[model samples]
Target: MRVKKLLLTLLLAFAALGSVALAEEHKATPAHETAASEEAAYESKSLWKMMTSFYDTTGLKAIIEPQDGVKNGLGQDMSKFSQSWGRVIMFAIIFFLFYLAIARGFEPLLLLPIAFGGLLANIPIANMTGEHGMLGIIYNMGISNEFFPLLIFMGVGAMTDFGPLLSRPKTALLGGAAQFGIFGSLVGAAMLSQYSGFVDFSLKQCSAISIIGGADGPTSIFIASALAPELLGAIAVAAYSYMALVPVIQPPIMKALTTVEERRIVMKTARKVHKLEKLVFPLLVIMMTALVLPDAAPLIGAFALGNFAKESGVVDRLSNEMQNSLINIVTIFLGLGVGSKLAAEQFLVAETMGIMIIGLLAFAAGTAAGVLMAKLMNKFSDEPINPLIGAAGVSAVPMAARVASKVGSEARPGNILLMHAMGPNVAGVIGSAVAAGVLLSIFK
Candidate 1:
């Protein structure tokens, strides 16, 4: 009876401990539910915050919000305008360039790349034009250091034939006269800066802008980079835009300045240039540039090297590469590098309008000057020189030459002025390089 009582007491004690433990678990259930609910709420809030942060960083936010303190070249705060409608205007301009490139076929090679680069540059938060960005790297690599323009000059030289210029040396006079527009526009720009109440352009800026008259894109870039980097974007756009519009711009001026008889005039065929003369010409030009105008030696030297390679006949591979592959690659990068400057902050300024107007006048002036010079030369020359060929003196190369030829043919079909016009076309290239050297000597 005593042993049974002891076992019954132990069972009763164990049952009481089990009942206490069950009551404790029942009491903790509400606390566990509260903690689980708190964790789920915290996770849900975190997910919402993440989505909000992502939206804040997107391009839509960047475009919609006005950047507070963007400044223009003149040190004016342009943020209110630039960050608002300026980007939109730039996009429209880029699209216009695209349309010109794709549909109108206006210098598709450079214009297309330029438009794309401008597109990248205008993206607000992406900072594609920042120092570390792709366009920035490209701009620094070639455009900033003045490397790409020289490469472009080299390519032009490789493709150029000096035969026309050599055959009729007097055509060079037309090229020299064409450059009157450069100086004339220089004076005009200086006057505009001084007299115009709205805009202020420094003498250096004027010098850079005036080079647009030459219609040589690389030369304009080279001079602008050295003389007025601030104005490079506007000046380059004006230069190339006018160049691409050569067919459109030159013909009107040629027709306005020349008489029907002058346009109809035809000339004798050009004498073939000796290979030795071709070989000696580039070297002689390089030597003269070195001795007379060392400031131009860099551009002239690269051009001479390309021509030498071509004329030597031994470096066909090198010449071909320079003409084809090297130039094609450099042209793309050059266009992009140039386009980086077309950002709203740089291009949408008041001075850009001035550049466009002056650039157009300068181009018209150059075309008229060339036509008049040709007409004057015709009065004295034994062989009749067509005034239409003078329009090619602006150095748009074969395009300007072709325009002259086309106009001449329209006046008198069967009259081919292509080869004849190339004389001034080639001379204009040399003349523009020389002009750039002069401007650099003065301003740089």
Candidate 2:
């Protein structure tokens, strides 16, 4: 009987606790629902405003009329129409680049990201490449500091084998000769500025544009960032676009410059290059170039360090990381950062047209000089060089070299000149950097 009484008392207490719990939940539910509704209303209003921003001046009014409620604003606002049209035009340009990258397979790795970033940058009302934006942060972090291109050069050095140039150091002359194109274009740029009112391109801007002739994208970007940050985008695009078109551009030029008989000439086998020579080459180049042109030290030093780490045999991990993981990472950012500079206001001007013209002239001049220099070298050297290989000195790296080899092979069924062309090919990299240093010094 006592137990039963105790159990009933316990049940009554539990029932009372359950009633209080239910009452509290019931009281809190209305407040929770009200808070959720308020958040939803706020989100819907914000979304409406965002949607209306796109049609701000497009003569589309009914879509946003209900939300705006205010009737004072015009149905068609043309205040910022030019900028809006500029964005539209930029989007079209980026899409065309996308087609080139994806559909046509033109330097897809870099071009694709560049196109995407351009797309992001020109998106009206998003401010995707504005200050503190994702692309802006990326650009300021590496490109503005002029650091990423040097990093890319380091990666390029790590992957490059200097054996071809080392075996036949004379071919380095072809590389040196090709740099005349850069200076030639400088003169052309100056003339354009002096004669044409289209652009008053300063010597600095001319230097940046002329570097495009080197056909070295990283070197081009590095020089442009330092000298003419304003023209970097147009110059980079022209440089890379021309580089991608090398096979088409070079073959015709090579064929035009070299006789059929000269193209058929076979090169002797390259002498065996010792590992010690390979290891010391980068150091020697850095010390020599840096001493002569301190301005080039940053780029040359970084390149030499990368090559040293690669050839030293003790720093395999560092070399691997630089060539593979690190370069890939930087390439993405570099592409995007460069693309950010292609905002419509910057690209639509007559100055960009001038840059494009100057860049083309620079490349053509470089190619012609390289070919002519090779012919001159042939007159002096008993070891007869295939003049076609001289065109590889423009520093498009393996692409220009391959074009030389391909042209040679077409002339002579079994003739192989790829390795021979590579001698001048790698030398062109050093030559271009030196040219950039010279220009930097002159203008400074």
Candidate 3:
């Protein structure tokens, strides 16, 4: 009788413990459910108001009607129409900004196309670049597997001339120096991820975000697509925005660094680059780069292929296509697809603003680093280069080079070194890609 009573008491104690645990778990579940539903409810209402207003203004009301089957991982199954409105309004704002820049004679060439692409890409309905939509399909075909960036590389190679860099190897260091911004931006992204409340960016997203400072869109896209596709929208937007803002950002630094006479410094025209040098340089570069940093194979290989096709005196048809039709077609889909990623769910947050600010700072720092390096190199070399050329070290191609040239011209009429700047311009390309590879290797 004593043993039986003892056993009964133990069973009663265990039952009480089990009941308490079950009650706690049951209580916790509802709290979570309540919070989630509240968040979903708030987001749905806010998004709905924004979309309806946008449709009312643009006569796209038909596009904003209720629909089904678009699951965004939010609480409610978000309607495609609403998401489309978000894209449309955001894209339109970007376009209007682009036009304002153009009217002000700001960076038009790049801003106009990128802004317009952002708008067209955001159109709802099929949202051609999202899932199964045609543009979305093409976008995936181009970006998912790294085709668009390489194709863009071909065009870049055709348009570039390396004579200045070959003639002046010292300028190469400036290109390398400017890449510190890329690393710095990576650190910034990591910091932001740690602090930002909504989305915690992964290591890959931080790495991809860092490439915005490279000042090369294709490189940004390539790195982002490879490591952090989620960041592609922001990275691309930030890269191009700073590229467009180069005129605004670079001028203050350039003026601060040099005296009027320094800005007016003249450079001799480069001697003719023999056909052999042009053809052999790409091959030698690829071999050396591959040996040193095999991680850079994709970008270097594409760059070399494009350069070779241009200089080989063969495959004229292939080179022409790569330069014009191929790049254009890829760019259209690439732009639209990249632009489409600017959904409100993705952008319109503190983190997005942080990325943009970090990117601009990186660009400014890169430009300063390049110019300072050039100024330092002058102490060691007999041949003097226009310090302004250092500004082109971010690899925006002739755009950056042109900005340098334009700034110099403002200081001194008849100053021209756009072609000479191309050397470091292309060098910056190689340097940025190498930096990107380093980040991927370390972080990815």
RMSD values for the candidates in order, in angstroms, are 19.1, 16.4, 17.2
Local error of candidate 1 at residue 274 (angstroms)? 0.7
Question: Comparing 2 and 3 by TM-score, which wins?
Answer: 2
Overall local distance difference test of candidate 3:
0.73
* lDDT score, candidate 2, position 320: 99
What would the TM-scores of all predictions be?
0.88, 0.83, 0.77
For model 2, the run of ten residues with the poorest summed lDDT: 69-78
* Candidates ranked, most accurate by lDDT first: 1, 2, 3
* Model 1 CA deviation exceeding 4 Å by range: 1-40, 69-78
Report lDDT per candidate: 0.85, 0.82, 0.73
State the displacement of the C-alpha of residue 259, model 1, in Å, after optimal TM-score superposition. 1.5
Candidate 2 residue-wise lDDT at 149: 93
Model 3 C-alpha lDDT per residue in residues 1-444, reported as the tens digit of each score = 443454456546745654664575466456556655677677755565565455444423334333566544223344454465555456446745555546654445445555655655555443444567654676677888878888788787876677778876677887887887788777877777777665477777777887888999899999988897867778887887788778788889878887787788888877776779988988998998778888788888888888888888788888888888988877776776676566554555556776787798789878888888888876676887778888888877778888888988898899887877777788899899899878767763
Model 1, 1-444: lDDT tens digits are 443454456546745654664564465456556655677678755664565457557654445556677543234465766765677788778877777777777888888888888888777667677777888889889988889999999999999999889889899998988887788899889888889856799989999999999889889999888888878888988888889999888888899888888889979998988999989989999999989899999899999999999999999999999999999999999999888888898889889999998899888888899999999999988898998888889888888899999999999989999999999999998888999899988864
Query: In terms of TM-score, which candidate is strongest?
Result: 1
lDDT of 2 by residue, 174-292 (tens): 99888988989999999999998879998889888999998899999999998998788888888888888888878888788888988888888989999999999998998898679
lDDT of 3 at 44: 57
Query: Which of the two candidates, 2 or 3, achieves a greater lDDT against the reference?
Result: 2
Residue 258 in model 1: shift from native, Å? 1.7
Q: How many residue pairs clash in each candidate at the backbone level?
A: 0, 0, 2
Model 3 lowest lDDT segment of ten: 57-66
